[model samples]
Every structure is written in structure tokens, then in C-alpha cells.
Target: MTRPQPRPGIDEIKPYVPGSAVTGFDGPVYKLASNESALGPSPKAMEAYEAAAGKLHIYPDGSARVLREALAARYGLAPELIVCGAGSDEILQLLCKAYLGPGDNIVMSRHGFSVYHILAQGCGASTKFAEEKNLTADVDALLAQVDENTRILFIANPNNPTGTAISGEELARLREGLREDVLLVVDAAYAEYMDWVDYDEGTSLVRAAIGTGAENTVMTRTFSKIYGLGGLRLGWAYCPPSIAEVLNKVRGPFNVSLSAIEAGVAAVSDDEFVDDNRDHNRRERARVTQRLRGLGFEVGDSHGNFVLAKGRGDAPVEDVTALIEFLKTRGVTVRQMGGYFLPDYVRISIGSTEANDVCLNAISEFASQ
Candidate 1:
């Protein structure tokens, strides 16, 4: 029999694991695994989706023009600068494919979003894991790792698993120090949850680069988080017009679905819904983080919809495992951070007040035990 052949990198790649979606467990399970909005989709977006369902037979606009226009208008950017994708994940992959190849390298934080490493490896590109300080991207450390061969740098604002953010000044410094040829891809997937005065989604950075005729910065955004459109799988990237053109060439023409396009357009226009969700997440994230820290866990300062708490520092791993199990029995599903290389930490998403109460109670009980 003939053996199936594959690329060496493909063989080494591990598939991403989504949060469990099992229903009808012994107790009611409040899933906080995936960093999704608990508020659900906006009424406007749902209406648009329902209206578009009848037109499923027709192919989606290849350029996603409607959604692009909506996003551009909202962001004060040119429509030509945007490239929509299935999700920000796809946009990240596109950047990797367009810019990275064998012999090229990308710089990323040690515990940044997994997609950066996955996409880099998928393209047969090497990665330099910049040492993070306090679970946040250390811009200076990342700058030190850059070389001529480093084609891309990915920074996840409000980084996953740890939910820590780098300040705007630090980001600007990193950009100033970066090699002219290196492209910075800022992933602002959780930008809406931030209430910091100096926090930026990297839009200004991208705009500054464009003004300077520098084509080395791109920023990605998603409809999945604050918009509650994870199921729609809609995301976009803002880049130099030249880079956007290259990505468009490599991207599948019909990468986005009809329903997704309609939902994305409506979602972007629903400012009230987005604002309300952001406000709720900001308030609850503080509440959750404070409560977790009060329980003697070292919780990081989070600017995202999730808060990460490090269990007892000197405690055994089994002790943490036991706490997780106890919480699972209480129907609160938080993300275990072993995969993200933080074994003593668990990430809990900011949910509705009631859901958060249940999770806090579970944690309290586990601590008492």
C-alpha cells in the first residue's frame, strides 16, 4: 500500500482544541472556556442574518464590500486598506503565507495567541519566542529578537491565557526600533474590553506607518468578541493598500459566507450593542479579578474579557488539578492554562453577572476545601 505523504511541518502541527460544547451534563455548565461574549448577538445583526438566509444560494460578495465599507466608515479608514477574512485567525494565516516562508522568522511573545505560532509553522517559517515579563509582551525583548530574516512580528493586545496588555508607549517604542522590512501584525481581538486611556487597537500605529510611506504595519480586528458573532467567523485586517492587494490575491475569493457578510455589516453598525457589551465586560472583569485575588491567587491586570489567576504558587499541581475538578463539578468551565505554558494558572471569561457569581462561588468553595 502507498503511504500518504505530507510536509514535515504539517506532521508536527497540533490541531487547535475548541471549548467543549456538550449539553445536558449532570449540572448546568456555564462555559467560560472560549473568550466569547455572554450577552449574545445584537438584535440588528440577528435580523440581518435572518434576512440573508433566504439568499444562501447566491454567493457572498467576493470582496465583502458592504462589510468593508461599514468597517472603514466606523474606523475612519479607507475601504481599500481592509481585507476581511473568515476570522482574524485566517487574516493571521494570510499574513504568514504572504510574508513568511522557509528561512524567514517571526517574533512573538512566549505565551501569545497560539495562532501566531501555528500560522508561522504552517508556512514553514521559524519563530523567535520573545521572553515575556509578567505574562505581558515585552516590547524591548521582542525588539532584541528582530533580525533581517524576521519578516513578521505578532503582538496580541490583552494576550490570551494571561490577559495582560502592553502599554501604547511600549508599543510605539517597539515599532520605532523594528527593522524597516519587518511587518508588525497587532492582533486586537480583545480591544473592546479595554477601558485604559492610552490603550489603542494599533490603528494609530498603522495610520502613522501609512503616513510615513512605511508598509510594515498591519492590525487585525474581529467581530467574534464584543459583537458576539463568533459563529459567523468574520474578521478583518487593516494594512497598506499594497499589502491588502497581495493578501487579496492569495486569499480565497469566497472565503467569507453570505450570512457572515450580512451579520458583520450589521454588527459593525450596531454601536449601542457593542458599547453595552464593552461596558459590562469592563465592570465584570474588575469584579472577577478582584474577587479571585482576594482568594489568594495572583491575578494579572487584565484588559480583556477574561481574567487569569495563578493558583497557590508553592502548591502542588495536583492541588490545582483538584480545584479545577471541583469547579467542573459545580458547572463552571474555566480554561486550564497548561497548554499555554502556564500550568498553575486558569483563565476565566467575564460573563453575565449571574454566571460570574456561580463561578466565584465555585472558586470560593474550592478554596475552602
Candidate 2:
């Protein structure tokens, strides 16, 4: 008898390559590969997680109502417009499932998150990548790529790996230029940490779309970054009421875990912890960018909690491949950006002072070689 075969596009999909978490020489390893909070979760969130341990047998609330209300209150959004998922990643996958299919396509920047491609194609859809300029998402270029088959356009605000972002005006222009039917999915996973004046996480656009009855835009955010809830895997999307209703229909009855809902509610309420983490990331990002540039490396203009550093000097240091091998030997693990199509750059997450210093010291030594 013949076995069941997988779908057509599934075979073409390349699995996402996550950042390195360990080095072979593991003496006091400093893991800075994934862009996560070094400051850790808030005390209140920790307490909430612990509180959830006693209720392990009870099923989680299928609607995730409490967490939805908390996110609405924190962001000044309507609870009815929010949808919670395992992570912003799940939210993206849900969108692909809802909107895309065979012969359909999603357009995005060439350097946008790899998961977008994975999510779209896994659902039997294709991806269209527009070019970028000056390491930033070019709005006109993206708009130019949108044709009749384009069902969704995904963009990572303060895009990962490169950590560069486009402004609100450019985003608005792109939205207005698109046909009313296409969905605009903005992945603002790094929104909380950005102190930029013009970045609004696409909330305003989503609201405006609702007001005009277009309801063509939405923004996805995560608890993994500033909230330090990576392990819990909680995230939400602020969408028009219609979109939220559609997502609720297809998602699992208890899509989010009890612990995640409890921890997320506590995490959003702790404004102080969030502020402190943002401040630390802001300061360290500046310091690290400056230090990397001073050491003769080309660092991207990053607005997220990490920076993209490329070797630009002579000899082995100029080759990022060698630089990564060198850092690995020193018990340091930073992400190689080749998967994101950035072969010459290494993306380093901003860590606590000691972690950052150790990572920098290792790089400094490599620069001297």
C-alpha cells in the first residue's frame, strides 16, 4: 500500500534557522544569538506563573479574555479587536491559514523575518520579496511588487537581523496605495523597546482601517521581548473586529495556555519593569553600536534591542564566517545572519552589562587579530 504524501508547497519550504544557543567550549557561555530580554521577566509575572502551577489540571480559558482585556487596557485598544495566540508567530501562521492558499501569494521585504516565508508557503501560498534601500524597507518598492495575486503583505517593523525600520508616513502611504482587499500584516515584535518618535506599531493604521470600514490592516506583537516571556509563548494581534472574529473561529479552543495567560496579564500590568528594560536596552544599544563602530566594524542603525555588526577591516576579521568561529572558541554565541540573506553580518542581542562586556571583549580581541 502507498503512504500518504505531503502537500506540494510543503516540500519547498525551508525550515527556520534559530539563533545559536550554545558553543562547543562551554565555560561560562554568553548566549546573545536570539533577541531576547537579558533583564528577565518581571517579579509580578514570575509570581503569576508560580500561582498557575496549582491549577495545572484545569483547562485554560478558551477565549483568553483576561489577557485580551489586559492588552486592550495597556494599549488603549478595544478588547473585541484583539486575538491572542501561542506567540506572534502563531498569529502569523493563523493569518496565512485564514487568507492564503494555492495560487495566492504574500509580499514582503527581502530581509523581513524568515518565518513569514515559512508560514505562507507551508499553507500552499507563495512569497514575493521586494528590494530594500539603505537597509530599510522601501515602501515604493514593496508597493510596486503588489499585483492581483498578492493577498497579504508582511513587514517586521524594526526588522530582525538588520534591526532597521521604516517610518509611519511611509507605512501609511503603502497602505493607502494598496487595494482595499489586501491584508497588511505588520509584525511589530520589537515595538516596546523602540523609543523612536514616529513608530506607532501600526496601531493607528489598523484603527484607521476599521474607521473607514476597510479593515485591511493588523499588527502583531509579542511578550517575548520587553516583557521577557519568551518561554511562555504569549502574543497578540490588534485587528479589526471582523478579523478577530474570523481568527477566533479557526483557532484552537484553548489556544493559549493557562500559565501564559496568567503571566501575560501580570507582565502587561508591570509598567515599571517594562520601562526599566526599555531604558537598559536603549542605553546598551547605543553603547554597543558605538563600541562596535569604534573597533572598525560596520553596525546597522538599529532601533531594536540588538544591533547587526559586520566585519569591515583587514584579514580574517573582514570575513564574518571566521569572526563567528573565533567568537565560538571564546565561549560566545551570536547569530549568523546568512539565513536572513545577510551573509556578512552577525546580529547580537543587547544583554546585561557583564554579558555585553564579555561579548564585546571577545570581539575586541578578534579585532586585534
Candidate 3:
């Protein structure tokens, strides 16, 4: 039986492999694979989510105006420029669908978020990767890769897997030199975890563009990280008015759910909760990196809520694989970075103090062996 053909690049997409969730031997599995919050959502957000249960029969506000307004209050972004989506992932997909096509290409850092590469391929567009210097996005290298075919360029500040970031000045330099025709997307999924004086998550650029009536750049954010709403699939993008209009037309009418909207609105209002999560992540991230280094591992300095643990020993790849197996046996789940081309590294999220201790102790045991 012959079937209708799919798109040219559809088959080439290796679907995203998420971080591991459980350990087979789990009595109490310490999940440090996904970069989720150590402390969960605010009590206010949880109450809002539960309150939404009564309205399940009715449809959500198609525009998500209330949530947009709340986000505007929190971030000082113009409500008209914000477009809510199921997740930043959905917004990214919308960007690809709106701009990508055969012969078009997207450029991103070599170790940037994996979803960018997958999304570009799914849209029948090719992806170009610029080499990273010291596990950080090299602005010049990224710009050098751009040509006539490049339609979009993505930079994940506090990038996934490696958890490294470039200074805002560096980012601005890239934007200043970039072709005005290319859409530059700054994915700030882990922005909430960063407090480095030099980091701005491209907001300054977006604000500057908005002031100049420019529309070639956008910044995307997620509720999944700091808000602990990963399960609810909520995120939004702050775009120039023109880009927002394009996204609104192509996006689902109710891309964000009632519960997600309510929770998100309440979550942003809980400034204390966000601050506490930031504090916990900051403290634990440093401790984890310190402990991993104490174990003789080459741990990278990370701004996000995770650290990349690389084996410093000879045969780093084999050592990392052995470390993974050893940790799994002890009921610890951590992310392997092979998919991101860092086969010798493991990305461990900063979990609760107990969870962090468990993971650190497990690695310590493995190193001792």
C-alpha cells in the first residue's frame, strides 16, 4: 500500500530525547536530569490552578489577555508584543513555520538547545552550527555562518546542556552585525536562574528594537523552569508588534490553557517565590560544581540551575559512561550530553539539598572506585 509522501526533511529529524526521569532501582529516585526547580510552584499558583478546575467545561480566553497583562506588569513588556503559546517550544515551532522553507537555513550555537535543530529540520529547513569557544556561544563564529540562505539565528543564553552564557555586550555585538533580514531569537528559558551583572537575556536588544520600530528580533521565555509549570506547558514570547501579529495568526486560538494562564498569572505575582527559587539554585549550583570538581571531574561554571560534569581522566568518554551507569545503579538520574555533542559530559540539575547530596555522594563513590 502506497502512502502519501511526507515533507523532505521530516524523516531526518531525530525527535528530541528528554532527560531521564526514573531510576530502575528507585526506592527514592533523585531526578537531577531535567533542569526543573528544586522547590515547586508558588502556593498561590497552585491555588489558582486548582481554582481553574471548576471552569474546565468552558473554553479558555483565546487571546490569553489577562496572562499577557500579568506578564507585562512583571517584565514591563508591552502587552501587544507578547504572544502566549503552549510552551516556548510551540512558539519556536511557529517561528519556523512562519519563516522557514526549503533551501532556508537556521544558525545556532553548536551546543545550543537541541529543539532549534529539530524544529528547523521539521520545517524542511537546514541547520548550521557555529563552533563554540570554551563551551560558550561565539558571536563571531555564529555570524560567519550566516549567508543568503539563513533565515533565522537562535541563541540560548545560559544555554542548555553546557549551562554557559555570553555577556550581553557580546550578544549586542552579534545583533549589531547581523543582517537585518534574519530573525534572531533569544531563548531565555533559564533566565530566572541568572543574576550575573552582565546578563540581560536580550531584553535590552528587544527594547531597543521596539523603540526603533524594528521587528527582526524576538525573545522567548518559559514557565517550565522557575514557575515549575513544565507539566502544564506554558510559555510566551515577547516580539515586536509586527512579529507578534504574525505569530498570533499562525498560533492556535487557545494555545495556552485556562489552568496554565491562571497559574502563570499568579506565579509571576509571587515575587518571593521566584526569589527563593533563584537563591536555592544559586547556592546549590555552586556547591554541586564544587563537589564534582572535588571528585576530580572537570565541572564547567554554569549560570543556569545546572552544571556540566566532564570526566577529566584519560578516556573521558568511557569514564563518563561508567559514571552514568554507576549513578543509575545508585538510583540517581542525570542527563547525558551525547546528543548535544558533549559525549564526555553529564548535565546535572540543581535539585533539593537532599537530592543534591545524594547525587554528589553517588559521584564521590564512583570516583573513589
Candidate 4:
């Protein structure tokens, strides 16, 4: 008997492993592993979500018009150029499926989001990883890896695992260096947490792409980070009209649920809540970074709501594992960076003051030992 075989690249695609949430400890767990919001979702969004319960029998608008319009009004973007998705993950996959083929490839920073490789490979395309500089995406390195068959370039602003970001000038240089035919996907999932003077969340680049008629750049944003809507799985992309059309064609007609649409509309409109969340993340991230450095760990300046840290001396991997084990015993959990090729480091999401203290205290005790 003959069995149906998967496509060539499908076999090569390593499944995407998400941040771990499980902890052997049964007590109150501080789950900083997933980088979720510390303060949780907005009250208005929650109210809207609760109200949406009545409409569970109804299907969401195929176009998600209200949510798109709300997003446009909030960001000063064109409604027609916005495409909503289950999450930025779906948007990324859609782009890969649309542009990549058997011989095509995508270029990304070596430590960029791991999902990009899986998505490209799922489309029968290969992935090229360019070397990074100081845990940040390097424009020259990424462009150097691009070949004639490279159809896409993915950059996660304020990249995960490392939590380092490139400046706006650097982003512009990268875009200018890329071929016009190549698509530049800027994943701005953690954009709300970035308050650096030179950093950009990618809206300006998307707008510039529209103004210059380049139409090659796309910026994807998520409610999962700042809005605390990860469970709802809501995200949208600010695309050029042409790319928006393609995504709309490829995405499910009702890709976004009624509850997500309602909650998203309320969440985006809650400017006060977003500002508060940003401020909280900024303060806590800085404090955590300073504390980690004080504890003799090498911590970098992070623009996102997380920090990447490692031991100062030779055996960083062992040090990280020991710290993680200790934190777990204290009911606090963080992430290891092995999947990002940074096994020596650990990625800790900035949480509430109590949670941060728990993690820090655990590390301090471990250090004392």
C-alpha cells in the first residue's frame, strides 16, 4: 500500500516550540516564560468580550471592517491597507505561502524569530540566517545573505529572546539595501513597550512604503503583547494595498472571531490603558535589567518587556540552567534561549513587582549558595 507523502520542505520543517508554561511547582506560579501582560487585559476589552458572549451564535464580519476601521483611526492608517489575522503568526505564514516556492528563500537575522524558518520551509522555501551584531539585527549581514531567489526578509523589531532592537536609521538602511522585488516584513509585536529615542515600531516604514510606491514593506502588530489579548489571538498587518489584497485573498473569510473583533475594537480604542501598560513595562524592564546586572549577570539594554541575561563567567549554560531550576522551585519561571542559538542566555519576561522580586530573590539565594 502506498501512503500520501508530504511536500519536500514539509519534512524538513521543525515544529515551532512555544515558550514553556509548565512548572513542577504547584504553588502560585509566576509565568514570565510567555511574555504575557503583567496587568492583564483592559477592562473595556474585557467588558466587550463578555458582551460578545451573546453573539456566539453569530459569525464575525468576513472583512472585520469595524476592527480594521478602528485600527486605522487609531494608527492614522488606511483601512483598506489593513488585514486582520488570527495573530501575526497567521499573517507571517500567509506572506510566506504567497511569495515563497521550491527554489525561493527568505533572509533573516540569525537570532530572529524561529517561526520564520518554519513558515518558509512549510512553503517549500529555504531560510538564510545572517549574523547579528550585539544581539541586534545587522543590516549589512542580512543583505549580504540575500540572493537572487530571496523573496522576503523578516525582522522582528525589539526581537524576542534577546529583546534588543535596531534603530530607525538602521532599519531604513536595511530597506534601502534590499531589492525592490523583495518583501520586508517588520514584526512589531512588542512595539508598545519600546520607548527608545531612535527606535521605531514600524508604522513609519509602512507609511513610507506607501508614499514611495515601494509597497514592499509590511508591518505586523499584535494585541497579545501590550493589550493582553494573547488568549484571543488577535493581530493585524499594515500592508500596502497590493499586499493587503493578497493576504485578504489567502486568509480565511472569517479568520477573526466575533469576540476577537469586538474585544480588539475596544482594546485599540483604550488609549489610556495602553499608555499605562507601556509605562509599567518600561519601569519594570529597567528595574529587572538593573537588578540582574547587579547580581553579576550580563544583561543588555532591552526595549521590549523582556530581558536576556547570562552569567558573567565561563559556564553560562550551566549557570542559566541552575537559575531556571531555582526559579522553578520558587514558583517563578523564565525561558531558556537554546532554540534561538543562545543557550548560554535566559530570557525573562518583565512581570509585576511581586513576581520580579520572587525571581530576583531566587537568583540571589542561588548566588549565595
lDDT of 2 by residue, 1-369 (tens): 899989988888889877776635848888788888979888789999999999999999999999999988888989988999999999998999999999999999998999999999998988899999977899999999999999999989989867898888888988888899999999999988777788768999999899989999999999999999998999999999889989998888999999999999999999999889999998999999999999988897898899998867564234788878888888778887877788777889999988999989988998887
TM-score on alpha carbons, each prediction? 0.96, 0.97, 0.98, 0.97
Per-candidate count of clashing residue pairs (backbone under 3 Å): 0, 0, 0, 0
Candidate 4: where are CA atoms >4 Å away? none
> What clash pairs does model 1 have?
none
Best by TM-score: 3
Q: Name the 10 consecutive residues with the lowest summed lDDT in model 4.
A: 17-26
Off by over 4 Å in 1: 21-24
lDDT of 3 by residue, 1-369 (tens): 999988898888899998776635938888888888799777789999999999999899999999999999888878888999998999999999999999999999999999999999988999999999999999999999999999999999989978889888898888887888899999999998887898878778887766766568899999999888899999999998889999999998878999999999999898889888999998988898888888899988898889998876779999888888888888888888999999998889999999999999988888888
For residue 8, give model 3's deviation from the true position in Å: 0.5
Prediction 4 global C-alpha lDDT? 0.90
lDDT for 318 in candidate 3 is 91
Error of 1 at 274 (Å): 1.4
